[model samples]
Target: MDKKINIYKDVEALSEGFTSLLKEELSKREIVNVSLSGGSTPKALFNYWVANCKESIDWNRIAFFWGDERCVRPTDEMSNFGMTKSLLFDKIPTIDKKKIHRIHGENESKEEVQWYTSIMDKYLPKENGLPVFDIMMLGMGDDGHTVSIFPHQIDLWNAEADCVTAQHPETGMERISLTGRLVNNSRNIVFLVTGKNKAEKVKQIIEEREKFADIYPAAKVNPVNGKLFWMLDEGAASLL
Candidate 1:
């Protein structure tokens, strides 16, 4: 469960650094498959990647996926697909629409989960029956939750299911998330957290937590046979 943590001062710097790393990874892999998390920080990074890395990427070789999303229409403001489209897809002309796979959380949570599972099963590298993603970009909430796995719901951490449709306790909306095992199977995992509010949880996950639990979903992020990196803004890294 060895992992590497990276700290930054702000979202802007994090975005720049991440975009640069993404471009480099793309150059090396030729085909880059990544699962992205939803949040303001990632939205900002999407915009930055669109503007800075669009031409550098081999658009057709990149596949886009989300780590989790609210069960809302693609047009909804809370929709992760909508945010990525608005901030990135619409701006990047080289990318083929087919390469950007958006989970239909709006229409079918279970169906989408199964469909995405099939997609991952078809595309990702497999070891011991699990698809190992190339890179999974995640975000941590102020409460220490990453993806839709919230505190008090550690059951999600141990979920043997590849994906699950759950409800956000506060929002009461449905969500589809890849199980911890699937995420930890990735070749690389990077968490992008911003704002001062997240500093405490970042510190707790990096310093205080041992095993991944519902109370600290981010603590569960350990890339299988790879590295886990955290890209944090100053406010989020303040406590670290």
Candidate 2:
């Protein structure tokens, strides 16, 4: 139940707010494993870091992973890895390519899930038998989904595996996501959400007054031995 909510004036300020936290964690940890999220808000953050944090932050000390990825070619427009590569990795030539442990979305679903799960086990530090990430970035869908686990698939939050394949409710596109067991075990869980579209669910989850608010995967983002944060822009926090 420990949570921190930060409301920013705009996406620019939101980017600055998260960078402050990221910098603090970087200063404390030798190797920071960050689980990246895909969405417009996070896009702003990746761009902000590449442009503003390039000089101050040491790319060598950080490793990048994704919270989830669509089952598509990495070059596809819907590919989360594609977006992050274009925005952050491509901009920072000094970044070590080996530090990026991207999910092979183009690879067959079952095979890729097993590969990524093993990669995480090998790279991340473990606590309570689960890999612990320094930071797990998340996004809240309009329907209150997070990490590709739709409201209809809320049960997957506590699935047995560290990673699971989730099918998009509407699109039916498959996605590989770090299950809640793994995400909640991380050292830090951050929800970087924006836009007016997110206001309704934001209010509901934060206040817990709306009916079925507990059903949201985003609402269950409690870190057992870590921290939970919701960094929102004015539009997203409007209803709060």
**TM-scores, each model vs. reference:** 0.93, 0.97
lDDT per residue for candidate 2 within 1-240, as digits (tens), equals 678999999999999989988889999988889999898988999888887888898888899999999999999999999999999899988788999999999999999889999999999999998899999999999989999888888899889998999999988999999898998998878899999989988998888834554578888777898988899999999998
Q: What is the lDDT of residue 82 in candidate 2?
A: 99
Cα error, residue 146 of model 1, in Å, equals 0.9
Q: Which stretches of candidate 2 lie over 4 Å from their true place?
A: 209-214
Top candidate (lDDT)? 2
Residue 162 alpha-carbon offset, candidate 2, angstroms: 0.4
Off by over 4 Å in 1: 211-214
- lDDT against the true structure, per candidate, is 0.80, 0.90
Backbone N/Cα/C clashes per model: 4, 0
Worst 10 residues of 1 by lDDT: 208-217
Residue-level lDDT tens digits of model 1 in 1-240: 657666766677788888766777787876788898888888888777876777776777888888888898999999998988988888888887887877887767878888978888887778767987678888887777787887767588669888888778787889988888888888778888888887778888888677544368777776667678888877788877
